[model samples]
Target: MSIVDRALNVKEQFLQELKELPYDTHSIKLFKDKYLGRKGLIADLFSSLKDETPQNRPNSGKVLNELRQFATREFEAKTVYIDNQNSKKNIGDHSLPEDPYLIGGIHPLTHTLNEINFIFTKLGFSTVYGPEVDTDFFNFEALNIPKHHPARDMQDTFYVKNGIVLRTHTSNTQIHTMLKNKPPIKIIAPGRVFRNEDISVRSYCLFHQVEGLYVDNNVSFSDLKGVLNYFAREMFGQSVKTRFRPSFFPFTEPSAEMDVSCIFCNQKGCNICKYEGWLEILGCGMVDPEVYKSVEYDYDKWSGYAFGMGIERIAMLKYGVKDIRLFYEGDVRFLGQFI
Candidate 1:
């Protein structure tokens, strides 16, 4: 008989057998083994295609493929029918309640970022984001961080080719926002930053940051201090005390680091605070005229303030998490505690 005729005969036989087949697990499994197993009839037919005449092989192959597809479709439908029948027969406890699936929660870092965003949003600052993979100008030059600047040493940036890099800080966004928009801008940048640093309890190679910027006709140091004071109070507690000590940053001429009295030690000093009564939370300063010059903003026409905090550090302090590495590791037990 021709291959097509043989295929038709096989399909007919399968249809007859399917009509008489018992709808049970054992019968359906045997049916699958006979027709669709690795060494079953369909495989044997495909293997035989190589022996057919070259000119005729295509048509024979088409018949065999159709037979296989038809058999597969019928087999799947039968299996599903049998399964449904079995399910109805096996209904032993319809009254029993289902075991509840566990619900997940916001990661501690995310929770802290949300809290920071909430506080800023309430203060008339809108959230903004920038690329993790960024250019040297936005990441360093535009922020007034030079190629050989000592501040570069602090970030330990991961360079990508000539002028590209994994952004070392969300401050990159400050430059981008300023360049794209006219002044009277207030924004908070929240995103991941990369650093080539040795991993330890207190530090990790990857972390998150929230950087803030405000530029307008008249902004000042006092305005910077007020915003930070409000942030510390809202994030920690209404009673938490903050301090700003003289510090230096490449992008800001008059820079200071903000610290909050250690909630863990209540200003008495502890290991978490490294025996200091304060925990450094963020860095802030008046926007340097040099930084404005890079973005073509008239330094004479505008003044602004910028501040940034490491989100991981904030989470560590707020949630009492010790190792920064724990935040990255997918440890359900550690994460579940936050929920």
Candidate 2:
């Protein structure tokens, strides 16, 4: 065959061999050495060109190089395609299914918070948020829990300056909401709160809370019970029961602690509920008249209720987590369980 025809024939044969290659690495390496390697067809062409006339030698060499370049690219692409095909086949049904046990899920706290927000949103409450680092005015005085109040000391707040503090509760956002918006206001503020407490199974320096507020003319105690009852049923189960125990707080005059029947033992009593057959889930009450006055709302013309709950506490009870510290420690083993 003429030199160009011979080179073209070799390239076509090389590509044909590539198409039939076994989808394996060893077979691929053998093909690579036989055609594209240094001692292969293109290398022999260099030696053969010396025998041609000077003019033909250059053309012959050009065609031979072109053939080698095309073949090299084609073979490289084929190698990748074959490797991928083999990889998929090896990972196919003949292979064992991966253990579903190895997979994980969303963090318990995140799951609980999402459920809480979902319920509130369905009830027409808008979600609002504010800064974690706040001034004493918004965190305390604005909420009617001013300096020197026993309630201020109850939170064990982390101070940043003389009066600046890491927010002790999501309640700080309530003041901002009131100041910026007029009544007919309904909002849920969910966020991280900080304290100065010693870390332990039950308490931590930081946690999360979701505080809710609803204000309008004619809001009353019955409205608070109705909303919380709906929340308990939706969060725990349709049959879950809730009760309001009279409580005291600086910001809410008719403050009460909300409790749901112990879900762990289904109100049969459990250690998680301190064996009392009840789990205190949140705090709720009517907003104090002083809180309204701070925002210049006419308390005599409007009345409302506010509620607050710790996210970590809800997460712990839902998942049976014994230690609050487990939620804060950045342990991969602990996190992977949720991921």
Q: TM per model?
A: 0.71, 0.70
Error of 2 at 299 (Å): 0.8
Give lDDT tens digits, candidate 2, residues 1-339: 667877877887887888788876788888888887789876777778878888798889888888888988898799788878878887767577677777667777888899999999999999999999999999999888877888876778788998899999999999999899898999999999999999899998889999999999899999999999998898888988898899998899899999999999987877788789999999999999999988999989999999999999888877788998888777778878666
lDDT of candidate 1 over 1-339, digit per residue (tens): 667777787788788888888986788778788778888777777888888899999999998988999999998897788788888898878797654446778999998999999999999999989999999989998888877877777768898898999999999999889889998999999999999999999888899999999999889999999999999999999879999999999999799999999999898889989889999999999999999999999999999999999999998899888889999898999998977
Cα lDDT over the full model 2? 0.88
Q: Total clashes, candidate 1?
A: 0
Off by over 4 Å in 2: 1-105, 336-339
The reply for model 1, stretches above 4 Å from the true place, is: 1-101
lDDT of each: 0.90, 0.88
